[model samples]
Target: MTERVYYTSDALEMETDVVSCTRQEDGRFHVVLSATLFHPQGGGQPSDRGTINGVPLLQAIQDGHTLVHIMEGPVQPGKAHLLVDAEVRNLHTRYHSAGHIIGLAGEKFGWLGVKGNHKPGDGRIVFDALATPEPMTIEALATEIGALVQRSESRIITEAEGKRLVTWGTLKPYACGGTHVLNTAEIGDIRLIKMKEKKGQLSVQYELDA
Candidate 1:
């Protein structure tokens, strides 16, 4: 049987024991713990950066349904301290919120397949669609996402509920296991970084303020 994953609901520092860890066939280290604040990689969000008993975390990918933190170095389980790269996580959180704003805009504009996109680099996101949008003006996309982030709408819904909000015809609701800002406004200054067509698909990229 696979091990059970543990996590915390709050972001504050709290000690958690590393219960167990082992090597997998795919070369990624599998870890389990009494609790963790580190968010696993999923939903277009990269894994949390951190260390385990002095070992550096490279990335995280979900193992079936469990949250695993992939690390480099020796790690023995049993009450190991938990640490998280809060600065990186903060940026990821902003990117995630920005992704949602794009989803909302896609819906308002009758675009489909807008969710389920995350470009891995510098907190960028891509809103994909089966059909290309008429080349949008930067200010137009910015005003849509920026206003939402500025509004900072406060709503914490479950996976089922979140999916319900961004439902587009024939498009599945995205389900990601990453930490997100409480409101849209937390994702400030999202710019439309790109738009491209490949094999008839149009992808819209979001730019993060440096």
Candidate 2:
């Protein structure tokens, strides 16, 4: 299993040991590191992009408890340098934090979040509701979310139970494992782009200002 450095720190780069490298049938090398700063594609957030041993990493995915770093070039079993793309990391962090903000807004507006997608260009949260509730307009949601972002009180906290929680101001603590900004202020402006209801699910789509 790879030590997940991303859990404790948001450092964009690190030096770690390559535990093993295996060639997959897809023609990519699956590199496992003793520790890594790479955030795998999980928890509605995308994978971190960068290089392992100076070779571009194609993707990072979780295989059971292990995080697999896929690359086009072969890496030997020894010391290696891990570098995460700063720009991509920043964008993912911002989007993920925005999702949490919107989730808080949903709770404030009596909507229960059943799922979330923090991916760039297609970020959204799906809520479970019995009926299409009023005040579901994009304008109303944007207004509420904007207020939360303006407060700039979001912070990450670790509980005695060992769960990492992200709290925005006085709202309820949300358990999340993905990377995020230090505060809601870093999320900047958010725009509600779409909202739809299907099969008793309310999907609220949003995007961050460039």
Candidate 3:
């Protein structure tokens, strides 16, 4: 199995041995490394884009226990360097961290966060109401989340099952595999786009101020 370096360290560059590199029918190459700082496309987050051995990386996909990195060309199966696009990584992490803050605020309003989509321009969090929420508005929820974001620092802890538990400051922890900011303060201004409730579920769409 490929060791996921992003799980512990958010470093944008690293070096690792290339276990294998094979050409696919589409002319692209599938490269496997000993470990990866590239976060694969999963868990409501997009795949990381960068260069491996100077070759443009397309994306990283999980094939069972191993991560197969798709690249524009092949590099020799040996020690290789990786450089992740900082802008992309930072934007994705901001969306992910913001989602968690929103979830926390929702919980305080009698909603249990159940699902999320942290993709750019389409960020959202879905929740299930446990008890009738004391009349809350989008502005109020945004204010609540903003308060937490200001003082929230992210912490990653490992469990026996090897799952990464992410927590912001003293708030609750969540089992997540996506990249996140070191602190919620880096998430920037969160703007609630829209909120809708249907079929006993509440979906809140949000965006970040550029």
Best by TM-score: 3
Candidate numbers, best lDDT first, in rank order = 3, 2, 1
Q: How much lDDT does candidate 2 score? A: 0.86
Give Cα-based local distance difference scores for all models. 0.61, 0.86, 0.89
TM-score of each: 0.74, 0.93, 0.94
For 78-150, candidate 3 gives per-residue lDDT tens digits of 9999999999999998999889999999999899899999998999999998868766689899999889888
Off by over 4 Å in 2: 130-134
- Candidate 3: segments with Cα more than 4 A from true spot: 152-161
lDDT winner: 3
Q: How close is candidate 1 to the true structure, as a TM-score?
A: 0.74
lDDT-best of 1 and 3: 3
Better of 1 and 3 by TM-score: 3
> Which digits, one per residue and each the tens of the lDDT, describe model 1 over residues 1-210?
222232215463446677677887776676766667777777677677877766778876667766667767547876576667778778877777667677766655445543455543544444455344555555676676666666656745344543423222322334555566665666677777675556644467775763
Native-to-model Cα distance after best TM-score fit, residue 200 in candidate 2, in Å? 2.3
Residue 157 miss distance in model 2 (angstroms): 2.3
RMSD of 1: 5.0
Instruction: Give me the runs in candidate 1 sitting further than 4 Å from their true place.
Output: 1-8, 23-29, 119-138, 159-175, 197-200
